[model samples]
Target: MLDARGLVIVFGLALGASACGGDDSSSGGGTGGASGSGGAVGGSGGGATGGTSGAGGGTGGASGSGGAGGGSGTGGSAGSGGAPCFDAKRLWFEDFETGDYSRWTSKTYDKNWNNGFCHDNGFSTAQANSPTHSHRSEITCADTQSHRGYGGLQFAGDSVVPAYTNQGSGIDAPNGVVNTYWSWLEAPYAFQNGKWFSFWTVNNDCGWKDNVITLGLEDTSNKLTPAHIKNTGGTVTFAPNAPGFPMGKWVRTTIYINYHEGVMVTWQDGTKVFEATFSRPDNDICQWHWGAYASGDNDDVVLYEDDNSIWKLGQKWTNFDVEPYFGVTQAVCSP
Candidate 1:
């Protein structure tokens, strides 16, 4: 579900922590069972360091509506087709139903970086993406520092995903790789500025760490800082972080790299919150890492990932706009 190695290269932000149990989630949208209780253990702050400043609280708008009470609700629209798929061959698929990390160990996405499963820090099937026997990937950060060795399950594309070099070339033109992280659980310690995690696309083929985005908390605002896509001439749209990004919910993010159109689209919870035209010449994508990374030490931070969360987006799905706001399973994608 993650390419942890690419995270280190991109933002030095580590992806980690236990399941978040997305509290305050509604029945139709956002993951449930996120009571923020039970197996929800607070990570040890490593007696060696002091506590973090933590995040400032954010408020959501009220749902009080002034409408015609007599009017009946309109029929809901039909949904998109197909379940989440990865790659043209579906070889990168992993639901973890077998309860193992064999898909990662079976073949390294790029051995030039690391090899085998980084089971030292470890990942297992503890959290459930769904109560009906569906499980999620609970990735633990290294007890020490940045887990560069092998903390992710990389899914290599036939050609780089989202075609890194050229905008209109390859799958990135129409079909880009999509990965969603159900931060269904987050320990209290994960609220610091040093908190960083890479969710999707990071170029492992070469060392172009520009558009490679990483999730983190902005020290000043204490909001989750979304990743930015960069071009050749030190160009980047320094946008503000989303108000309540990783606060114990499944934040669905989609990255659409359009070199031809000269635009890069970032969708959060199914909204086109950020868009930028790249001045760079070309773009190439290699892998997607669903694990953890850290700016400082791995500490006790541990992030959760749903086994069925990773997805492949057919070109048209990108234009769905906010259709996916209903959360993961309910949101439809083109086959």
Candidate 2:
């Protein structure tokens, strides 16, 4: 509990003396005016009249001015700060538990690994028919291959691999592929026109590898692509090479969309890295996906993702009773 209190003191002092002391009677034949003492009678033998003495100086008035009022002091309340508040009804996935699949979809090639291609069960695989699975593996680099890694569905876990086998895509072409790191975000269905929001992070290859994060806006007419779309204009790329960027570490990425403005801001750890606004309207509203595609087959290239979560802006976490999959609150500070 906290309390506040105020204290005040007032004081006043007078500066001048009162005018109450004055003589009135005269001695002999002379009369004296107000404040003067009468003198003794002149040399006459007769007894001289008594002179009145001036009244004593009036007492001086009291001393200095009134004092001022004092200010109040208050004690601040105690509580936790930076706790993340998420919408329980709107959560897509937590603790890698799949609630529904109709809301998400994925893109896969039948048998074509054109870039250092291999259907070698290492990269992409499905998690237990459930929306979430324990899928974790690294894509290693190779010398002759242009694109060394395979893209796959990532789930929640510190480090655990699902017990599924990866199907092969036999179109291995080293030169046609490039080396890069990226991730994917799958949604059961298309997001509403003005109600979709998503956030995630992508890990870079330390050196020589170009890592990027993409928000697949399947809706071609909606606005939100101008700030991210490159010359080819297919998908918006959040890259680490941008100027004033704090590169070489994990960076947090955010996407906010509505009618007025489609803004994208990326932060390194917790500090802002880059912000971009798109002039063109984005209309894509299909299932979203995040992953990597490279130019050469350098199997060593990889991307890491964690703390993947989403929420509608202005929504509070307490309104819903849904718990996080891991049994812990996913609410986190902006770090």
lDDT of 1 by residue, 72-109 (tens): 11111232463342222111333333333343311222
- Give the best candidate by TM-score: 1
Candidate 2 residues 1-335, lDDT tens each? 00111000000000011110001111111111111110111110101000001000011000000001101111111112433433221122211122111111122211222331331212122321112221222233333221211222211211111211112121121111011111222223332232221121111111101212233121222111221223212233434543221112333333332212423443322223334433323222111123222212224322322223222233322211222211122332221
lDDT of each: 0.30, 0.20
Error of 1 at 90 (Å): 6.9
Q: Which parts of model 2 have CA positions greater than 4 angstroms off? A: 1-91, 94-104, 107-134, 137-260, 297-299, 314-335
Prediction 1 TM-score vs. true: 0.50
Report the number of the highest-lDDT candidate. Answer: 1
Candidate 1 has its poorest 10 consecutive residues by lDDT at: 53-62
